[model samples]
Target: MKAVRYTLISGMLLLGMVFMKPTVVVSQCAMCSLNAENSTQHGNTQGKGLNNGILFLLGAPFLIGAGIGILWYKKYRTKSPKQTLLSHHS
Candidate 1:
């Protein structure tokens, strides 16, 4: 229990630090990155939008997987009461 509590606290603190100041992470393939950079240099918003869309797509699967994992963990971690069979003697 103590280990679990400490782990949870540590995870929360790490997540807090991460969320405190968000930074943009490049999530583009080499060809896509080159194209986006080239288009942006020419003053086109399409490149910026493309980057944003890529970031969204990159984060979505992990976000969904994390959500599902959390749900599964919670569902299994909980303990349910067990029923006992009653036998009748004639």
Candidate 2:
């Protein structure tokens, strides 16, 4: 019963997310956008470089967090249940 309820909830959430329209997020502040626009108007490549740098900076934390989570899961998942119990007893 509990499993069915959880599955239903998960399905609902999944469908909701699938049906949702994605929003465009502006990562740059007004000043940054203006600077990039001005640079682009002058035909400088700095604006494109700056945008790439911003995207890299924005994505870094999520990548680091996913790496840490994967490492943690790998470290813990290799232990048997009996070994885990014995370790707690010690």
Candidate 3:
């Protein structure tokens, strides 16, 4: 069952990566978008940097949450029934 779950997750991740588009999505407020556009129009390369920064910022929370979740899973899932019994009896 664990192997099946791992295989399924791996397949889904592989499929998502295969189908994912390599498009830049800058998630910012309207004013920020306008400012970025204006800067780009003025021949400044700051807009690209801003976009990359936004992507990094946007990804940080999800990465952190995933790390926390994996840690929690490892802590809870690694204990066998025999280990639990032995620990409690000591």
Each model's lDDT comes to 0.84, 0.82, 0.86
Better of 1 and 3 by TM-score: 3
Tens digit per residue, CA lDDT, model 2, 20-79: 946643478789999999998998888878877887889889899989998998788754
Ten consecutive residues with minimal summed lDDT in candidate 3? 77-86
User: How do the predictions measure up, each by TM-score?
Assistant: 0.62, 0.51, 0.64
Q: Write the per-residue lDDT of candidate 1 for residues 17-54, one digit (tens) a residue.
A: 88886586677889999999999899888888888898
Please list all clashing residue pairs in model 3, or write none if there are none. Answer: none
Residue pairs in clash, model 1: none
Runs of candidate 3 exceeding 4 Å displacement: 1-15, 18-22, 78-90
**14 in model 1: Cα distance from truth in Å?**
7.4
10 residues in a row with least lDDT, candidate 2 = 77-86
**Selected candidate, larger lDDT, 1 vs 2:** 1
Which candidate leads the pack in lDDT?
3
